[model samples]
Target: MMTIGMIVMLIASVVMVLASFLSKKTTTDREKSSPFECGFDPMNSSRLPFSIRFFMIAIIFLIFDVEIALILPMVMTMKSSNLMIWTSTSLFFIFILLAGLYHEWNQGALNWSA
Candidate 1:
């Protein structure tokens, strides 16, 4: 069994080495190597200004994503949990989510247009 394993390892190593050599690119192209951004040159300074609105929208998306993750488990736990407690907890959680959405909406974070 040990000898068979050793032989398999040897064969795998040889095949990997050959594959790597065969797959190696002969020449590297500057355009292909750099990141593509809507046909824009990526060779320029990477420290470009980022949009604050875009960042805020991303953060809001992440927060809701996490909240959805938390809420999904509650559905499964409903079968085992007390009905009254479960109802209150679910309602409270949904209320909080709505409140947060309202706050962001009022603050104009949800507005795409100025």
Candidate 2:
């Protein structure tokens, strides 16, 4: 007997193959083929300059979000059981977090008035 994981994988693969075959006759035209821009033509040659600060903030957010996801489960486990585990995990997570915050502070990424 196939395991549940294997049965699910097989069903997923069959569905994907059927979807691909059904979509083969889709039309192509100048409007359909060209890059879509919300029905707007590409008129401008040079794009506007974007500040790296916004991108930096987005990257930093993603980093912290992932870090939180990884640590929250462990943190919760500590909270439910023992104070020693709680203190150790909290200190470990906070230490690296503070280090990252210090780096960002020094590099001026945290500055919004720039």
Candidate 3:
């Protein structure tokens, strides 16, 4: 029974891999592969320098946003959790987050202008 099951699995895997390869064409088209820019030819390089301040602010916002999302579930689970432990855990997490924020602020990554 195990041999039969293994044989069936092997056959299925071979068939799926063959199907994928058979579906792909060897033909290559430069226009199709090149990135589109509103149907216009690209005059400049695609890579551009991004603002570090903007990137840092975006990362900070995302970190806080995710923290809020995680905290929401803790609120729902609070009734089931030990009060003292929960409060201490929550305070520690927030303190860590604030510490990170303070570190970033001290590094001047939060500043927009040079």
Candidate 4:
């Protein structure tokens, strides 16, 4: 096992040395660093302000998607689990999900228009 590990480490080091020597060297050029858009140089700033609403909506979607994934597994375990415990747990989870949704809705994160 020691011999095998040593051999693997030797091979990895050889590979790393070869990769470093064989890698392409980048030449510094002003035009190469500049952003190209349809054969024309960019007229405006590349870092433009984005809508916060879109980001909020995406986060909300991810939260709900994860909740759905959690809920699906709970459904599969329903047969083995106690009915009262399962019902209460599911209702609690659903209530939290609804509360989050309500909070986002009230915050105007769901609104598309400025």
Local distance difference test, each candidate: 0.92, 0.81, 0.90, 0.89
Q: How accurate is candidate 2 locally (lDDT)?
A: 0.81
Candidate 4 lDDT (Cα, 0 to 1): 0.89
What CA RMSD would you report for each candidate? 3.3, 5.9, 3.4, 3.0
Clashing pairs counted in every model = 0, 0, 0, 0
Clashing pairs in 1: none
TM-score of every candidate relative to the true structure: 0.63, 0.60, 0.66, 0.77
Q: Write the per-residue lDDT of candidate 3 for residues 1-114, one digit (tens) a residue.
A: 999999999999999999999999799888777778995557678787998888999999999999999989989989999999999999998999999999999899985465
On a 0 to 100 scale, what is the lDDT of residue 81 in model 1? 100
Best model per lDDT: 1
- The lowest-lDDT stretch of 10 consecutive residues in candidate 4 is 39-48
lDDT: the better of candidates 1 and 3: 1
Ranking by lDDT: 1, 3, 4, 2
Which model, 1 or 2, shows the larger TM-score? Answer: 1
Score candidate 1 by TM-score against the native: 0.63
Q: Write the residue-wise lDDT of candidate 1 on 1-114 in tens digits.
A: 999999999999999999999999999998898888885668777788998778878998999999999999999999999999999999999999999989988888788786
